[model samples]
Target: MPPEDEPKVEIKLCSENDLVLLNKAIPEPGYHERRFASQQDGKASYLLAWQNGVPVGHLLIKWEGSGPQVNKYLPDTPELNAIGVWPPKNRSKGIGGQLIEKAEGMAKEKGFKQVALAVEIDNSRAKELYEKLGYMDWGHGEYIDEWVEKGDDGEETQHKDPCYYLVKNLE
Candidate 1:
């Protein structure tokens, strides 16, 4: 059970209908576009945690074929990526932990034996959260994270970042 200050939330896979709602609720730019594209291609699963009909957090589970690191460490495992909590004020209330748990459940349902993810070397806060949720630093390796977004003028912009890999056995 959550503490008195933490609000209760329901975590579930985002449906096609939920995509529209997520786009409106999430303040981060390009989040909706990326997740929507993944969903349309059936390459990823987006899970959202709702509290009082509002989205409090979200996580993405990308299939093995989509993440290079997952293919290398645990080829059959899904990669839990792009996790975030909205409103900044809603953080540290167990919403992030709940999102991770929901991602693990989805991976298990898909027959994956493990789950993997990458964290920026300097992101101590996120690293700590993953560790607390049972994810461990399996090894040290660099990954080139890339994404493309469209500008208001219809031009596309690409971004990249380097990160370290982590994994967790679901069994």
Candidate 2:
């Protein structure tokens, strides 16, 4: 049991209605919408962590790997992407760990031998968490991470993040 004041967190597969609530809570423009579409199309799985019936965090599992290195090497491993907990105040509360554990379970259920993720070179905190969870550096060096962010003005901006890959084998 958690402390009385700690919010009870529930993890679930992202639902269509959940997107509306998430958008209202996080307001990331078209981010959730696009991810939801990919989930519907069987290209990915978007998991949402809800606290008090509101989305506080999310993790996206791409059925196929991303980046030249991931594609070239771990082609069959699902890649966990864009994991985060919002409100800034929610950071360092184990929400991210919960999301990652759930994703690993889902991948195991799907018979994947391994799961992988990328951590930005500068994000020492995230890297430490991944390491504590048994994710090891892939030792393939770093690569440029690419993503698109949609603005409130309805325009898309491409981002390039320098990151290294990590991998974990499922039991």
Candidate 3:
């Protein structure tokens, strides 16, 4: 683990512009952080993965609401919505996991009972990382028929991707 006060990395409050950068970082972003931030106060926070003063990763949290998979499950659960480390150059350096831990810490600081998130069931890398860090599955269901799985090589696979609800008990 990096030092508690690593100058190269920071977990800070963000504005609307941060959300735009986060959307660009994640493949299919669903919500912009600023808009969500507009409706929330005292219960939300975002963390940026910075290195050498560049925003290389994003970790945005939100109160319980339905994200992409809400149709398959209710949206009443609070969660850390979008977390992504940008580009090949910025990934696998432990930033993604760090942001999640930071977000979970922040959520606890803000007094949320537990933190929840939705992940594409097929993304084992992300899921494994989450599980290894103590996040657990609460529920899951299949895609909306039009969805198709794509491999790292960009080849389509018949596996219908299901989205899962993941939770981390804060207390």
TM-score of each: 0.86, 0.92, 0.65
- Which digits, one per residue and each the tens of the lDDT, describe model 1 over residues 42-61? 89988889998888788888
Q: So what's the TM-score on candidate 3?
A: 0.65
CA lDDT, candidate 1, residue 114: 87
- Candidate 3 Cα lDDT to native: 0.64
Clash total of candidate 2: 0
Q: What are the root-mean-square deviations of the candidates from the true structure over C-alphas?
A: 2.3, 2.1, 6.5
Model 2 earns a TM-score of 0.92
Q: Please, what are the lDDT tens digits per residue for candidate 3 over residues 119-167?
A: 7867888888888878887655443223445555767767544576677
On lDDT, the candidate that comes out on top is: 2
Model 1 accuracy (lDDT, Cα): 0.79
Task: Locate the minimum summed-lDDT window of 10 residues in model 1.
Answer: 64-73
Error of 2 at 4 (Å): 10
Higher-TM-score candidate of 1 and 3: 1
Candidate 2 lDDT over residue span 12-43, tens digit each: 99989897899998887788988899999999
